[model samples]
Target: MDVSQVLRMNGGDRDYSYSNNSFLQRKVISMTKPIIDDALANLYLDMNHPKNLIMADLGCSSGPNTLLVASELIKSIDKIRLKLGSDELPEIQFYLNDLPHNDFNTIFHYVSKFQKNLRNQMLSNSSPTCYVSGVPGSFYNRLFPRKSIHFVYSSYSLMWLSQVPEMVNTNKGNIYMSTTSPPSVIKAYHEQFQNDFFTFLKCRAEEVVSGGCMVLTILGRQSDDPCSKECCYVWDLLATSLNDMVSEGLIEEEKLDSFNIPQYTPSPKVSNEVEKEGSFVIDRLEVSEVNWDASTDHNLNLSGEHEQGYNMGKCMRAVAEPLVLSHFGESVIEEVFKRYTNNIKVSMSKEKTTLVNVTVSMTRKG
Candidate 1:
């Protein structure tokens, strides 16, 4: 099966769903609010007095986070409209986009309720009419009409490559490009990211109007090293768990050798090069360190390493279980994660695990 056919966040509103496990992603969104606000403010300022506004949230997985993005964008645009004392507010059309396999029905189910809430919050007679629709496809390709979108927002996405590189089999006993991966493996991942990211920008450039803005928050590395501990440790631990299973005759070692994660955490410099090669101008770029256990509730008295390991395991499994299930089959999932949780607990007992996130603000240049 292809990557697009399988990659999706854990669906439905169950306890282990993406909706519940996405607190970390939600934190990424919250931390970048100032950047989002500035980009939207500039977009509104540049538009002057448009009658309608079109926006999109790319990689909008199924969850509260999906609607949270739309709601926040709507609220921000409305505030700008009120501040400018515009005689008439523009009608806003929002496109929520993700892979074809995304649980869009879950988002659609909540649309009416979300719209009703938005309606109640409007305080002015000139309030903008909001329309929300889902666009199912890869963001690496064009999904909107030419020169249509005014603003674009994506959070906790884009670190994902379109697919795992064909040459990834060369990297033995690893699911991602790690410190020990051959230079060829590293090169393959980097090349794939450059290709996908450039394609992404090209597609969006055709869709967004001139002077439009995009604010993206993506998992990235802070340093030039692609195999930095912050970028590769999670996958290293996951690989260790898989290896443990292999040792126990639970899963084939060949399966572990064949599988590689279809994701990359690029450095800021790489991002800059891709943007420069595309149709946008970088307005702002910021990298922030986020603790792996950022979502843990310290107040819950979950102080021990075991509890911390459990929390981290749940979070990673929610985001990654779908892909792992597709590659390794469902039978080994529980055992795999069981070992994964223990590995995390042992690691957390030693030192803090922090992941670097990159937030980029850009404008589509004419």
Candidate 2:
């Protein structure tokens, strides 16, 4: 399967759209704001005064978060400019990137409103001319000209491999690596991530200018064990849901065995790929756990887990609906997620599980 085509989140601003269900991503973006501010402050301090700045938000799937992030960068820079009292403002270029199947049209459609709000907010000062363009393609390949970008930020991406591993029957009855998966299956997943991340680093090394910074947030694991409950429980539960459907004859057993999610929850050691490729230096690697449901910030229903589990199901459906449709067809989605919700309730009741998030900050060598 072509991951670029099928790996997109559900688009548009509907109930199940990524736009609505992306509170977790929103929290990730907020958590990285200080890192971004530091990167921008350091960018200005490290280089001679420049008249233009180019930044790229990799895998910038369509949503309000897209503009929220852009605004955050602009606001951070505005603070710097105010502090420095600089009359000469640098022109800013924002390359909003994603795959061909992403909802670029919706993003573009909202740009007018976004621009107007930006202008209104910055009316008191000289704001940089912000140009937003959509670049459609995979970041695993080169997406920008040599030394073209100044700051690069990506979040909740980079876990997806370019393609699924080409092995057969290694992880039967499951869609992703679980505790029950064999060593061979785990080895294949790690090898694929090593290659993909190296390529991503090498490509960015060429595109990002000297002294530039890249602040990335990736989904990862807490334990060295690849199959630990912290790393694989969510997917394992999903696979269990699929298996239940197959037992009920709602889905094909053969299809369940063949499907594999082309994502890996990497350890911080995964950054060794950067040292291996030798283009950038890792500035900082930090790990934090986020609630599986962003709404848990308020209260978690550990007793029955109805609302929380239902929210988790909606979130998963927003991200996984397309992939399931591409491979398993549309017939089983409702039932699969129905069972997935119930399974999440039982599992959450048993254990209050959280997602492991890894944030990495890096800088390109001069």
Candidate 3:
């Protein structure tokens, strides 16, 4: 998995595609800070030891979210270090893991900035000398040494698996997301999601130390039903736009038909699978039901086709533009992005309740 190749496929830009707007994602990460603090507090209180604990942020994208999360974790470790009366702080090693196509340079820049800030924070005292590292590979395989990581955190990145289901590709369109489609398409997607999720859990368990705690957060749905229109609105809109392009002969229908984002929604069933893995026991699990008004839509685009009036949209474009352009062509790319913006505006104006259920789960290895 060459880094360049991965970036080429994922639209190259490693920055947050939609981070310009202070949308729910930024808000969610902020609101969840106390949650991480509480979890770390409990881990320090209950775990065998705390002073030298290790922490890693798996699938940390290059943006404010990663930096903020890392800072919080460092603070938690500092607090615990003081309580133990140990001069030695935990060795904070951050694993900025993403697909090969991830912007490692941006992540590296942020890691350096974070380290510099940490250095400044501990000018007078012996602070935990944080070691920053980058892991440019899929989380589906060995990401670190066995039992090496003590505290692992990943946010908003795991729901997208490595690839979508082959069965969905067999269909001319993503019938699973279509408003008028058979129930089986949804069932197939649900099954594929389960498979991908279990694989993710098993892989992480192998890397995490026994008694290690991982705070895993992802974009999920509150409903167990796979056919929930609210949960699939973004996908539906994109698919519809692609169909429009296809009908207009902008791009081949086959190209649109074969494309799919490797995504999955979590449910209690997936939680049960985590428990069954025998490596992780769920310590905490909660879903934040989030909805936002139009005022929060962070639109930063000033142009025609690249314009996405939402911060999240812009950030997403950075991540997806290269691939979209190559696959859909320049003209189609503009049209699709325009349609995406229009769809988002419609969703916002109609007070459409776009369901983005965040599942914050803490698991400890056996």
For each candidate, what is the lDDT? Answer: 0.85, 0.84, 0.63
Estimate the lDDT of model 1.
0.85
Rank ordering of all candidates by lDDT, starting from the highest: 1, 2, 3
How many residue pairs clash (N, CA or C atoms closer than 3 angstroms) in each of the candidate models, in the order given? 0, 0, 13
- Per-residue error at 227 for model 3, in Å? 2.2
Predicted structure with the largest lDDT when compared to the true one = 1
* Per-model TM-score versus the true fold: 0.94, 0.95, 0.84
Model 3 ranges off by over 4 Å: 1-24, 47-49, 83-88, 119-126, 292-309
Angstrom error at residue 239, model 1 = 0.5
Model 1 weakest lDDT span, ten residues long: 297-306
Model 3, 297-354: lDDT tens per residue?
4454345643333433553455556556655667766677767667765666566455
Give residue 238's lDDT in candidate 1 (0 to 100). Answer: 96
Which whole-number lDDT from 0 to 100 does residue 94 have in model 2? Answer: 92
Cα distance off (Å), candidate 3, residue 31? 2.4
Off by over 4 Å in 1: 120-128, 297-306
